[model samples]
Target: MSAERYEYVPHHLLRRRVRDIASGVEGELMAVINENVSDSPLREHWVELAHIRGASGREFTTAAANVVPA
Candidate 1:
C-alpha cells in the first residue's frame, strides 16, 4: 500500500449502501444457505458431499459424529 498509487474515490469518506427497493437496490442480504442435515435419515450422503465438495465444505465432523447426523 502506497499513497503515491492514488486513483478515483481519491479522498475517502464513508458511505452507507442504500438497501430499499425504492432506492433501486434490494433490501435483503443475499446468501447461499447450506441445507440442514441435522435430522436427515440419509446423513451418510451429506458426509460424502463434504468430501466431494472438498476444502470449502464441512471438513470436520462433530463430537457425536453419526449419532448427531451429518
Candidate 2:
C-alpha cells in the first residue's frame, strides 16, 4: 500500500530525529502535567495548538486520558 500513497493515514516508522524531538516535547508536557509546573517548549506549542484548534490543553489532556487506542 505504500508503493505510492494511500488516502488514509499510514503506519510507518518515524525518523529517529523526529521521534526524539516528539519524545522530548512529550516529556516536558508530561512533566508539567505531573508536577503542575515546569518550563517547557511544549507550553509554547500547546498555546499554538490552542490558538489554532480553539481548545485548551486541559481539554486535550482530558480527551487523551479517555482515549481507547487502536
Candidate 3:
C-alpha cells in the first residue's frame, strides 16, 4: 500500500481583510489554528475572523481555503 502525502502551504493571514467564499462573509482575520494529526501528514488550516456582521462584531472559524484576501 502507498502512503498519502500533502503539500504544506504557508499563509500569512493575520490582521488581514479576508472573505469566506462559501458564506459570502467578509471580516478581518483574527487567528489561524493549525491542527496536526498524528497518523497523517495532513495539517488543517482553520481561520477565525471578526466583524462578520452587525455592530456586535461576531466571529467565526472556517477552513483556510474558504478565505481569500478582500
Candidate 4:
C-alpha cells in the first residue's frame, strides 16, 4: 500500500488562491461555490473570502486541481 499525499492548506488560503487565479477578470475562470458539491459553511466561507479579495467570481471545483497554480 502507498501512503496518501496530503498538503495542509487552510480554507482561507484556498480562497486567496482562487482570487489570485481569477485576477479580477470576469469569465469562466472566476471562482464559484457550487452548493451541490459543497457544504453550506464551506461554500459560504469561500464565497465570502473570494469577494473580499476582489474575486467574487471565479471558477469552482470540488478538488484542488481546479484551483489555479500560484
lDDT of each: 0.22, 0.20, 0.58, 0.33
TM-score of each: 0.16, 0.14, 0.54, 0.19
The C-alpha stretches of model 3 lying farther than 4 A from their native spots are: 1-10, 36-55
Which of the two, 3 or 4, has more TM-score?
3
lDDT string for model 3 (1-70, tens) is 1242333344686677888787877887766554443453354433332322312488876677687887
Candidate 1 local lDDT, 1-70, one digit each (tens): 2222212221111121112222232211212122244444444222211111113342222211111111
Per-residue CA lDDT of model 2 for 23-53, tens digit only, reads 1222112211212222453442221111011
Candidate maximizing TM-score: 3
Residue 31 alpha-carbon offset, candidate 4, angstroms: 11
Could you tell me which residue pairs clash in candidate 3? none
Q: Which stretches of candidate 1 lie over 4 Å from their true place?
A: 1-26, 41-70
Per-residue CA lDDT of model 4 for 1-70, tens digit only, reads 1132222344434434332343433222233332232344333322222222333443433343334434
Better of 1 and 3 by lDDT: 3
lDDT for position 54 in model 4:
31
Worst 10 residues of 2 by lDDT: 46-55
- Candidate 1 vs candidate 4: which has greater TM-score? 4
Those runs of model 4 whose alpha carbons end farther than 4 Å from true positions after fitting are 1-12, 17-59
Pairs that collide, model 4: 30-57, 30-58, 30-59, 31-57, 31-58, 31-59
